[model samples]
Target: MINSVLMLLIASALSSSALAKSCPEVLDSTQRKLNAVEQVNLCDEFQGKVLLVVNTASQCGFTGQFEQLEQLHKKYQDQGFAVVGFPSNDFNQDRGSEEKTAKVCYLDFGVTFPMMARSSIKGAKANPVFTEIARQSGVVPRWNFYKYVIDREGNVVGTFASSTSPVSQDITSVIENNL
Candidate 1:
């Protein structure tokens, strides 16, 4: 009986170690949904999916990209792809409050993809997800709507400027190739 118990413990430790190694550091974060109490762990929610991560602002010129982003998300979601938005006021363009931000994203733009609560996207205070993304991609958000495309394994495969359209060939190509 003692030998059997020891073997069970060894198997459990090995399983946990394998799980920890498979989850990328970039996805090792839990974030609240915009204006919602529920939180999602990135690894648990998005592991093995191709992800388009964008830092967004409600009042920015690129806010309209939310529409195309939603389209992208819908088009590829069944194929293990997703578009995740992080609303930010770091550039002073986001709505004044989370309520307003949620309105703009859900009511105005009809954003169906996951949108995280407002957070810092640049400098020292950037959230853990973005900080790790920037570290892995060697790029940072210069303005609202900057995007990073991550592969299923959580490696940043592409970095896009705020000017790039969500449906642009450049962005779509990377997503398609990775997916």
Candidate 2:
């Protein structure tokens, strides 16, 4: 009961979006396609907030996780956190082009948070941002929807498997304490 009350208090305390914050020191100067938006300034786009980066795929069974991700993003957004999606075609055949894939995600899921371009999240061609995520989290995503949680200070605090939901206790704890 005390834990639940504490959670409520923390959630209430963090009641504003950090999306507009000045870009932090961690994000790089990389421009990638955002859902329907043309090349957006990545770092400038999401400067001050805590971030949850997930490698997503359209055809995967784990695709249903989008709803949970959206929930987490929406619930914690006012608290300075975001769920950033990276649609990848790396495994078991990804459907649609990069833009089309992102479109499907937005239209189907009402994903309000940032969704970046499709990229290889594994092997030799993985994007530098992801490589950095992996290097810090100490876990290369084995498949799509693998989550890397970045704290407000830009530390890669944790990595979760594809099986882990965005609302998982571990993830929630990280956001509550680190964000």
Candidate 3:
């Protein structure tokens, strides 16, 4: 009887441990500020799908990535991929409020994907998600438009430098494989 009880207890503990899911090695928290951008639940946003989280700016040199990002979203959105854009003034690359920034993204790039609140994307005050992405991928952005690819299972699959174009074969291949 004692052995049976112990076995049952062990089994229960093991199952509980196995059921606890971990988020991607990148971006940390689901709770964060939502100002100009839409307030989003990361878990719900990417549930059962691959997500491309990019730190964006309105005035930065890499801003053109936004156009390519839109194209990627258009290409893969129907196939289980999403591009989550987070505007940041962390590097002073973004210069306006969320609505103000959205105007620029809309008029300049015609973005259709989700836009997130403005937050610091680097250093001590960086958004939890971006911080975790930097830690997991080991490729912190040197500038804006740095892209982090989250696999369908929510793992940090790759980190592209700010200069890495969204249309590059490397990024497209990942999208192709996952989608």
Candidate 2: residue pairs that collide: 16-78, 23-47
Model 1 segments more than 4 A misplaced = 1-21
**Model 3: runs farther than 4 Å from truth?**
1-28, 31-38
TM-score of candidate 2 on Cα atoms, chains taken together: 0.80
Backbone Cα, N, C clashes tallied per candidate: 0, 2, 3
**TM-scores for candidates 1 onward, in order:** 0.90, 0.80, 0.81
C-alpha local distance difference test of each model: 0.95, 0.79, 0.78
lDDT score, candidate 1, position 80 = 100
List, residue by residue over 1-179, the lDDT tens digit for candidate 3: 99999999999999886655554444335643334323556765676688888888988888878889999899889999989888888787688666678787887789888777788777898778877777777777777888888887767887888888998999988877776
Q: List ranges where model 2 is wrong by over 4 Å.
A: 1-26, 35-37
User: Candidate 3: worst 10 consecutive residues by lDDT?
Assistant: 31-40
Best candidate, TM-score:
1
